[model samples]
Target: MCSCQQHSGTANSTSAPKDAISFRVEDMTCGHCAGTIKKAIEGQLPGSAVTADPASKLVSVVGAADFSAIKSIVTGAGYTPSPDRVS
Candidate 1:
């Protein structure tokens, strides 16, 4: 089943996120999709770190990347980034 649960790495974690964005990516169906999103995010924002998991449908990013820019990159990469949680 596809999971749309929010990625809480930015909010619930004890350590502050290196970048301030974490949210649910509902379209990740496999490792390839996860990698594509990760590469796209990192490419768009050089020096950024991205960890995307297809199993959890979660993406955690740590960098200076803008949220809107990230969303655009994800959309451009044929994926859907739904809902921004905890800023």
Candidate 2:
């Protein structure tokens, strides 16, 4: 599942922007997986903000990102990313 959740308030130095595109990564089951996913996205998309939460299995990106690209990145990092549904 995935979602585009609207957010507000100050952008933390490391926080994804308000218009975050989120993906549900079922295979991201721990901090290490989250870090790998985050690293992969950030590495490919410089100047983008990424927040990967292992507990929630949510990977949010704030920058020039779309579902296909995000899914590709996650898949390249050996995980599965599903789009546009919450749960």
Candidate 3:
């Protein structure tokens, strides 16, 4: 798995609500894209359960984390989340 250390903030680092969420990602087109997005999320949330499916362009995250933080890491991984942001 690829290691992304540029952004390694704990999900608890924020006071915002932490819960599981499923949202569409606009640019997850391949396995590599899914893996990259997964890694990016894990990099920050550590124990967070992140499931990214290239076929569906949806990423499901279960654990602690703020929406902005999650979005930032996803974008940094070279993917754009859907316009809806969260689903």
Best by lDDT: 1
Ten-residue region with minimum lDDT total, candidate 1: 7-16
- For candidate 1, lDDT tens digit of each residue in 1-87? 224345332222323374557767788876677777888899889988887767677777788557788888888998889858444
lDDT of 3 at 5: 34
* C-alpha TM-scores of all predictions: 0.74, 0.74, 0.71
- Give the candidates in order of TM-score, highest first: 2, 1, 3
What ordering of candidates by lDDT runs from best to worst? 1, 2, 3
What are the per-residue Cα lDDT tens digits for candidate 3 across 13-46? 1111246676787667666667778888998888
Name the weakest run of 10 consecutive residues (lDDT summed) in model 3: 8-17
**Root-mean-square deviation (CA) per prediction:** 6.4, 8.6, 9.4
Candidate 2 local distance difference test against the native: 0.69
Candidate 2's residue-wise lDDT over 11-78, tens digit each?
22333456888767776666677777888999998887788876667778878546688788888888
